[model samples]
Target: MQNAGDWTRRLREIGIYAVIGAFLTIISPYNGSGNLPLWGAYLYWTGLVLTGSLSAEATRTLMERTGRKFGVPVMLALMSVTSALAVTAMIILLEALTSGRSIPPGYLPRLFGLVWVIAAAVTAVGIMIERTVLAPVTEPVKGASPEETFLSRLPVKYRTAELYAVSAEDHYLRIHTSHGEELILMRLADAMRELAGADGLQVHRSWWVAKSAVRDTRKQGSKLSLVLPSGKEAPVSRTFQAEVKAAGLSA
Candidate 1:
């Protein structure tokens, strides 16, 4: 379902490229064999943009996959490649469609070279903008919500008992605490994103317990449980029981 969101967002972005391609195709109408109408050109460009700019992971996921720290250069390159592919494919589709038939023999080379060069330019600009401006502005929006900030800046500390981690409850976050968990609203990934610095690990689809609050670790057969400070026990599935144990806590 979240991937559906990503797909939808990708299509919308490609559609923006299509819109630009439509304007350009109209500017210099292809005078080849077909002389396709403006709408057809637009549709072709849209489809092409969708094809070329297929879904790729967002900056964060890409970093995690690469097992390297996120790099400003890499992220910018990715975004630029994304934008250029979307833009280039749209242009090619328009050029081909206007020819009324097959893609031109010489089109492939130009498409390849143009995509890489333009992608580099776009990536550079995108990277510059993100590091210089966008990242600074958006950084606070991640977990530094107003309320969270207020809590952080409180005259007295308040988060001494909270436990945080991803919970896969139909794509929602189930935040656990000494007070027991309340599904405080957030995407599992986004919730994990905010909880990145906290000392907790996602142990299951329905749980994420803090190490400090783990009262006791007990196992019956293969199942393990994390007893909380309040005497409530949260199950630690086999998948993450090892992690809990490795963290020097019993399971």
Candidate 2:
């Protein structure tokens, strides 16, 4: 299921990039293919846009994994600059291959500037789409036992135990309960759907905590965590800090 979702997301991204590429081809920005036929222009722009967009996304993901906090504007700027440099090199290579002559050193700076503008625009659009269109839609599970939906999926031993938290680990989820912890082959987003009506909140990108299981809130510098009865702590990311605080889970 996770693999299927991943493929769907990839296809959607490719489709969006392809549209943007087609638009660029129509406009023929910077006279990128002034001498080429229409079909050749389409091929060049589509490939270039797809490559640049993917490169920007990779840089953004790497930046996120660094664990260093950055404002959205700053992160976008950094991603655009990094991707622009990489794409500029690709552009130079492509020009050399097609024109049988390398781009002059004097034109390198201008080329980089053009690439940066396009990179920044595309990067911003991609982020907006991810936050909006690609975000998970969690509807409430209407029933007497909202927790039952997810509890039934737990190991037999933990079916009656109190759920403490659910943390994502690669392709699986680590279910924390009063009895013990168990790993399940499930995505956090899927788990979240089942847990929609449960008395809990997603405290981090990779963590969801039951409200009843929280003993107190812990703060260290700028970091915040929800302390559970079992001595387990669920870290709260900046993105969800406001929701955690509103839920009275913050100190």
What's each prediction's TM-score? 0.35, 0.59
Number of backbone collisions per candidate, in order? Answer: 0, 0
Predictions in order: lDDT: 0.52, 0.80
User: Could you report the Cα RMSD, in angstroms, for every candidate shown?
Assistant: 13.8, 9.6
User: How well does candidate 1 match the true structure, expressed as C-alpha RMSD?
Assistant: 13.8
- What is candidate 1's CA lDDT for residue 193? 57
Model 2: residues with Cα > 4 Å off, grouped in runs: 1-3, 137-196, 200-251
What's the true lDDT of residue 224 in model 1?
Answer: 81
Best-matching candidate per TM-score: 2
Please list the residue runs of candidate 1 whose C-alpha ends up more than 4 Å from where it truly belongs after superposition: 1-161, 164-168
What is the TM-score (0 to 1) of candidate 2? Answer: 0.59
* Model 1, span 48-137: residue lDDT tens: 444443422254356555644333445556665666656565666666566555556687666666665644653454334323333212
- Evaluate residue 94 in candidate 1 and report its C-alpha lDDT on the 0 to 100 scale: 61
